[model samples]
Target: MKLTLTLVTIALSINAVFAQKTNPNYDPELATELKADDYGMKTYVFVILKTGTNESKDEELINSSFAGHMANIKRLVEENKLIVAGPMLKNEKNYRGIFILNVSTIKEAELLLQSDPAILEKFLEPELFLWYGSAALSEYLEASDKIWKTKY
Candidate 1:
């Protein structure tokens, strides 16, 4: 299954390159908000899931933990604490499991990440990313509301 997913990612990347060649410059339809400095200082993390062995890989625990992760994100959104959150597709390879979230600071972001069942309980090793972008940050946050509302 994992191998199949990897092949799928490779195929997707090749297609994306060709898609770009024809279009050359497709942009995100969402509008961007450009408080670049402020947003840049803020931290956005991306988690890449490592392997899950044995008991932790049990379907129930994996599903339950994912729920907890989403529940935590929902709570943060309700409080207006999260700027954006979502799973990322594999770029060119299929090590594709993780989420991106925007928080006020790296410390706080790490704390929130550690709260996730996968990380907190040693269920998986996750990677982190502090993304840098101009207005893209705002666009993602805006799109995120729609995603949360199930409009996406």
Candidate 2:
């Protein structure tokens, strides 16, 4: 009987040790605002901007389209729709850049991409996928704005 009680006690102790505990730093308000799950993560659309078939050598068109693209990026960021956007270095895949959009569906992301002049002009093509990442990812933009000396 003593051995049985000791074994049960050991089993209960092990279960307690392995049980999930609530995060000490968890912020319910922030999590709710961000639409985060219990793990503090939410869904986003990840876009890979690739070089498109529009290889026109027209410098004027290229310049104008790219300028509009940059402007579109700023506008989306201001609207809190685009959480991340940046160019990638030269690669074999012809990937030009990436954008992590703060949107839930691929259709929504496609609609937002339609606003980009680069995509409209066929200078860049987007391949989108649903991404699961930390809800606080957008918060980085606050500090990012302070650190950039030159406006892109």
Candidate 3:
């Protein structure tokens, strides 16, 4: 399943590259809003959430920790600090999930992550790095609200 998902991601990436080659149907205003570079890319803080060594055996603690963890995610999204976040399908390399922060600096991203219960409780550890991705990522919060009827 992981292999399949990886292949699908690769295929989609290739498709996007080719699709942009012909006519992008580009929007000049959106480009300005997103601060898109020549390649339509923008900087972000990429965070990898990994399983920490300090796991508690108590179910109650785990449940409470995860609840707060999710709440924090919602808060960040509402604040427009986090553009993307989701868990990985596989546990390869102890990686549990990811967070793509709409911030330019690691320090800013770290401060935000510090509020997560998962991080505080040692259920999750974060590794942050600078990343460049499609400027369209900056529009995800608004786009997601339009597409999904569910609210958190």
Best by TM-score, which number? Answer: 2
- What's the lDDT of the predicted structure labeled candidate 2? 0.97
| Residue pairs with backbone overlap in model 1 | none
**Per-candidate clash tally:** 0, 0, 0
> All candidates' lDDT scores?
0.59, 0.97, 0.89
Cα deviation of 25, candidate 1, in Å: 22
Comparing 1 with 3 on TM-score, the higher-scoring candidate is 3
By the lDDT metric, which is better: model 2 or model 3? 2
Root-mean-square deviation of candidate 1: 16.1
What TM-score, to 2 decimals, does candidate 3 have?
Answer: 0.74
lDDT tens digits, residues 1-152, model 3? 99999999999999998884633777888889888886889899999999987768999889998999999999999888899999987866999999999898999998999999889999999999999999888676777678877765
**lDDT per residue, candidate 1, 57-78, as tens digits?**
4788788876786787677766
In model 2, the Cα lDDT at residue 64 comes to 96
Model 1 stretches astray by more than 4 angstroms? 1-35, 38-43, 52-57, 88-94, 143-152
TM-score of each: 0.50, 0.95, 0.74
lDDT of 1 at 124: 56
